[model samples]
Target: MDSSKIINIIIALFLPPLAVFMARGWGQDCIIDIILTIIVFFPGMLYALYIVLKD
Candidate 1:
């Protein structure tokens, strides 16, 4: 993957909201990211990646 994606993955793994907070541009996106993380649990990194790439 690209460096930007890698960085976002790291942030997502260490701090899920940090990646979403940096990648998205709206409050609703952040809320969605949080919800995805909570719902998926261990797969939160993948969810964050989806959120970042979707943007």
Candidate 2:
């Protein structure tokens, strides 16, 4: 993985929504990440990692 991806993954483990925002910007994916974070933290982290890795 690239350094940026590693950094994003690290961020995702901490602030999932922010990581998603960094990866996808202010859009649906970010919104979903925020919502998932609000609902549950781990799922949000997983989702953020998925978003970061998917691209």
Candidate 3:
């Protein structure tokens, strides 16, 4: 992966919603990430990693 993806991964691990927003822009994915984060952090982080690294 390039530097950006690497950065996104790091961000995803720490802040799932922001990472999802960075990867997907403003959309349903962002909302989902936010909701996941609100419900529980681990799942949100995992989802963020998936979204960021799936390129």
Candidate 4:
């Protein structure tokens, strides 16, 4: 509902890794996201949302 949340969702929708990347940093997590996205569609999306929204 807030601007930060909205921005995070938008970022996640566009590029899932970016959400986690922003939350944590540009590192192993981004690699994990890419692997998840490759293995299962939307898993990375949900993961990103969880990380961003959980905070």
Candidate 5:
């Protein structure tokens, strides 16, 4: 796919909140990603991947 997406995926794997922030800006998606990351890292990572791939 796109290089930026690949980078975002890598970032998402390491830090989901940051990845969401980069993709969606300071919005609800970013907040949700932060919460999910705080609650459970795996779920947050998955959510971030979904968000990134969706666009």
Candidate 6:
């Protein structure tokens, strides 16, 4: 994977919302990530990684 993808994955592991924001900005995906983080951490991480990888 690219360096940026690696960075995003690392960030997603630690802070899912931040990773989503980095990948998608302050858009719907980021908002959803934040909400998922608030509800549960693992789901947020998965969602963030999905967004990062999907892009």
TM-score of each: 0.61, 0.93, 0.95, 0.75, 0.94, 0.93
Pick by TM-score: which candidate is best?
3
Candidate 6, 1-55: lDDT as tens digits: 8999999999999999999998889999999999999999999999998999999
RMSD of 2: 0.7
lDDT of each: 0.76, 0.94, 0.92, 0.84, 0.94, 0.93
How far off is residue 35 in model 4, in Å? 1.2
**The CA-based lDDT of model 3 is what?**
0.92
- lDDT for 55 in candidate 3 is 63
Which TM-score value belongs to model 5?
0.94
For model 1 the TM-score comes to: 0.61
* Model 5 per-residue lDDT tens digits across residues 1-55: 9899999999999999999999999999999999999998999999999999998
Off by over 4 Å in 5: none
Candidate 4 regions off by >4 Å?
none
1-55: candidate 2 lDDT, tens digit per residue: 8899999989999999999999989999999989999999989999999999998
Cα RMSD of all models vs. native, in order, equals: 2.5, 0.7, 0.6, 1.7, 0.6, 0.7
What global local distance difference test value does model 4 have? 0.84
Off by over 4 Å in 2: none
Better of 3 and 6 by TM-score: 3
* Residue 15 lDDT, candidate 2, scale 0-100: 99
**Predicted candidate 3 versus true structure: per-residue lDDT over 1-55, tens digit per residue:** 7899999999999999999899889999899989999999999998999999886
Off by over 4 Å in 6: none
Ranking by TM-score: 3, 5, 6, 2, 4, 1
